[model samples]
Target chain A: MQKTLKSLSNKDPQNIILIGNPNTGKTTLFNSLTGLNQKVGNFPGVTVDKKTGNFNYKETKINVVDLPGTYSLSPNSEDERIAKSYLEETNQNDIIVVVADATNLKRNLLLFTQIVDLGKQVILVLNMMDLLQKNTQEIDFKKLSKKLNCPIIPINARLDKGVEKLKEAVFSYQQKENIFLDSDSSSSSIDETMKRVGKINTIVDDCLTKDGEDKSYLFTKKIDNIVTHKIYGYLIFLGILFFIFQAIFSWASYPMDLIDSGFGFLCDFVSNILPKGILNDLIVNGILAGLGGIVIFVPQIAILFAFITILEDTGYMSRVSFLMDRILRQFGLNGKSIIPIISSTACAIPAIMGARTISNYKERLITIMVAPLISCSARIPVYTILIALIVSEEETYGIFNLQGLLVMGLYLLGFVAAILSAWVMKLIIKSKQKSTFTLEMPIYRTPRWKNVGFEILSKVKIFLFDAGKIIIAISIVLWVLSSYAPGNKFEDISKKYTSETSQQQYSEQEISTLIASERLEHSYAGIIGKIIEPTIKPLGFDWKIGISLVTSFAAREVFVGTMATLYSVGDADNTMSIREKMMAAKNHETGEKLYTTATTLSLLIFYVFAMQCMATLAVVYRETNSIKWPIIQVVYMGALAYFSSLLVYSIFS
Target chain B: MGKSLNMTLDRLKENESGIIKQINDEDLAIQLLSMGFVIGEKIKVERIAPLKDPILITSGSSYISIRNADAKNIEIIV
Candidate 1:
């Protein structure tokens, strides 16, 4: 009968579901089983999707579905609902892998016992066994297995221990275990159920000998005393944040410079070979320079994600959420809102999507509304360049660089703006529904470097791919716009500079630079910039900035690239860095320096509040499945940016 | 205790009980309902999954899980 059941399930590729509470090392187990073969997708008719991966255990090809981490199959959130539905379907899963945290076995068993009664083929995995060793705690696995009437394997997922035993248990899985609940009609009452559970607890106690004291709760209380204390907690959190930003600035510089120089060399090499024509000029000046401008900032973005991934993986994020909950509640947000807010520092799309975790509709809406206000990674390039241009490197307050201080100020301003806006929205959109914030503070463990590395690489790849596509297309268009115009002397000038005798006579730098400038001034992009000159003039922006503004709608980081390309026109040999080009720029009409401190400040403030990217808006729409919020976001942010820039420009000018 | 209130696991209030007849919600709902929730399965109210929201119930079969806010909508007779 067991063989017949196995064969029948095998004919349909039985779905082996992995279920566990949050922070049980469930994801690590999934990674081990699937390696890089896993794919994430949404479940049918539900926004909360399932992540399924394939692996072969013995001769059986198993399709493993990694359910979302939940304390129990309580349908409070969308994630929980999706997880519960898949598990309840009798025919859906052939076996269930219940990953439980060994350190907190009492609470973990709350879910394990439930799975046992479901009559599903069960493999109980005691994850984080290493943490038990660290805490000097031991569990009798043999007794645990016997008590539960299921195979139990102790695993240290972080160290990849006992995984083979887990696989072996899966291979040797049998359906004959008498783990199912007997339908006793006499004990159908609530009192009877409680009595049975009490009796089971007695059985559990008899079978297992718990050793070295349960210090998990005590440890949490001790840590919470200092970390979540009102005044000191806030101070420590601020201090940690300050250090992270400082590290991002100081550590990323070396790699950033290397990338910049490498791209510069590549540009020069292309300029050397391509025989001084439109094709050569486009490749070296337009494409390479535009891409290099954004590529140089990748190191900083990657490092920022690395820190975030570590914080999230080590289970510190929930504690941070718990600590911040009280403060956030004051602004119509919950402690849970911090996740989305922090994620928004990378990009608002995912951050807004993350708002779904917040159970309260009103709080979730407020989070989504205000998330875009947090300066995202796209804004980083703009901020870095602008701060470098305006703020000197002198130390302030005896410990912080003036540039670093300015960057910090911008981040704080965004956060302040987000909170203030949320507060206002709360007043207008009143919700009387009672919302509770209950978060499980998971045990802290050393971050698995593999997961962190994978997260960073995936995010960086996504950022690069999305930004690269837009930059390349816009660069080509800008090249065409700046290269030719009807009845213009621009083409004539470019040809003359590239003519055989003139090209040979003139230095390579002079020849390339002349062709670049001529092409840009006559390109289609230049015409559009000239047309928009009137509109942007009041904000102290030139036609070059107009072109940049247009391109930056795709992504804010493209502003730096647009400026690089615009300035590269006049730069001899493309030798000057973006900063040097910006510093050298002078207004053609006014003859005043284009990137004066006032203008830089104005640009910085403009970018601080602008809904500059169409991509972010698209993502927001997709994530929320609503056009209303994204449209409102764009209009409000655009107005804020314009008026703020106008205010700064007027005051300074 | 208090008239020995009898209600179905689904019909139980913010803190009520009835045997889970069928779990309609997916993912979380199913997981919570399934732990000890099967046809004709008996359950007792434990606390809730925090926040006095989802009711935590222990099934007679030796497992505990939470039910939805509307879980009280289910009918039961003692």
Candidate 2:
């Protein structure tokens, strides 16, 4: 007991909390210190990411927590609130490392001085030293360090320089009694901040010397001349958006195909190795199929995230936000909502998470609520199969494929619906918080590729694990609901199909297939479908379509898998076979073809508008931190889908 | 503090420079100050967005964009 207690005490001062202003390269320093040893979690009672990592120095493990960047100790946003609260809770054993951009020391030091005045043990790290050197500027760090009563270290975080010195400083950090502003002398928070700024300006001027004017912003301003030009800016923004869409749809398809086939091969292997039983079916059909559906979207998501990270790292996203803020704010969304709105095309889960940057409560909530209305990549499979039902691949209107044109129209329809919903919500959901867009526009630079890689890895991990767990569990439940019946109905179907006369009338393969389809009709899922058939009948959907709708509620792409089972189609990948089977299906009462143009188009419209993605709802619940929002989302979106599909069915029929 | 002596930042043309006299809103003042926009400091209008609502401005080494409504709260001397 004594030895353990001694060891525990020796491990004291193991934590180093990193804080800084926006665009200060603080994250780069954290990456250099932790180097993939990091994990992102949520702060207690909130969804803000709490990134904590550990690194070893001299055989001792030092843990680091990278806090969100904020302009001051006063909180203006959720991120800043969490950062400030976390800082206030730190004990004496924890040392605060304030990373400041050397090129912009005047603004960066405001955060550092605030932390130092908090009476916490702190070390000042001056990052971006290389940029300062390029401008022929010099900082008398020793004098600055003495005046501030803090140990200051200069290093280029991007190149991993001076990281060792930073770690060394963390080990030897001593608490200093310092205060930049006397709080009691100020009449308000604003007055205190102004006084602090006045003091910092003097200190910065005394220690820093410049040989010439900084040329960094000169180049940035030159590029901005064209990039932010009135006509050219809007055109360039659209061009880049079009390019991103093309990349997502075309480039991502190759990897998506690979993942699809790979999962198929794995399913086959598992089925062959295991004995034909409930367990084998569950593994191959239920669990593996569900896993594949989620993983198949990885390529599209990664590509989208890569592009977004590059844009942000190069400081272009802020420019885009500046250009878009005025227009978006008219619809109750902040400028930062542009990222999440566009991101919804690839997936809504990450898109919803991306709304964290909006800062304003009402705007962020509206962005989250309406984001799922935009079509995502998971809708691609359903659209392809359904569009092919009415329009052939060979059919074209001039140069555009008819099927492709219809898909684009569906995408456009989704965008219009989303914008309209946001506008309506803006009028309904009331808030007292004022909306402001005071965004920093960092100077452009080449993206840190390593940081981009880390971002992709972390986001993909969250999607695959956090959302994947719920998807797999729901799929298993759906499988059991569809595979089993109330009585010995499944056995009865099998037994009748095994009769000698039946065998003679139909081939062995035909008999089995017939039994499979008949058995599904008697299953619990079929009963549920029949129960809801009357409600969906106005949408030109039959009981079979109802079954597909119910099953696909767990995931939009599962409509294909469920349809394959309903028709007893052996291969789910063979879209042509499914199309043929669906074409032959008939209305039980009228004896008319089931997949008419009206019904197919209605179904396509439903997929476009419906809240069919369970993962998105789950993410919405987590992000909003309230059951009310997700419930509201489901009801509103479902009503929209039903009414829209009803309208399309009427117009076409 | 006369109206004739002060001009709001929103009226400044692109590439124009001014000295900040006051920020009308207290919260906005704290925000701008912490972001390195102190009083008596020279601020330059970098660019007005394409739509002419939110404009980018630079003070010292800090550059940021604020909407026209927020910019109107900032009093400056040309």
- Number of the predicted model whose TM-score against the real structure is largest: 2
Candidate lDDT scores, in order, read 0.73, 0.82
TM-score of 1: 0.81
Cα deviation at A38, candidate 1, in Å, is 4.6
Against the true two-chain complex, what DockQ does each candidate achieve? 0.06, 0.84
Write candidate 1's Cα lDDT for A332-442 as tens digits: 998789998988888887687678778777898899889988999888898988787776555565777667778888888888989998998888778886565655555
**Model 1 chain A worst lDDT run, 10 consecutive residues:** A188-197
Runs off by more than 4 Å, candidate 2: A1-13, A353-360, A377-408, A430-433, A544-548, A551-597, A613-627, B1-4
Model 1 error, position A432 (Å): 2.9
- Candidate 2's error at A232, in angstroms? 1.7
Residue pairs with backbone overlap in model 2 = none
Model 2: residue A20 alpha-carbon error in angstroms: 1.0
Interface RMSD of 1: 9.0
**Candidate 1 at residue A567, lDDT?**
82
User: Candidate 1: misplaced stretches above 4 Å?
Assistant: A1-15, A36-64, A86-94, A112-121, A133-149, A172-203, A392-397, A486-489, A492-519, B1-78
Q: For candidate 2, write residues A236-328 as lDDT tens digits.
A: 887786566556656776897799788768877887898988788777767876677678778877876788788889988788888888888
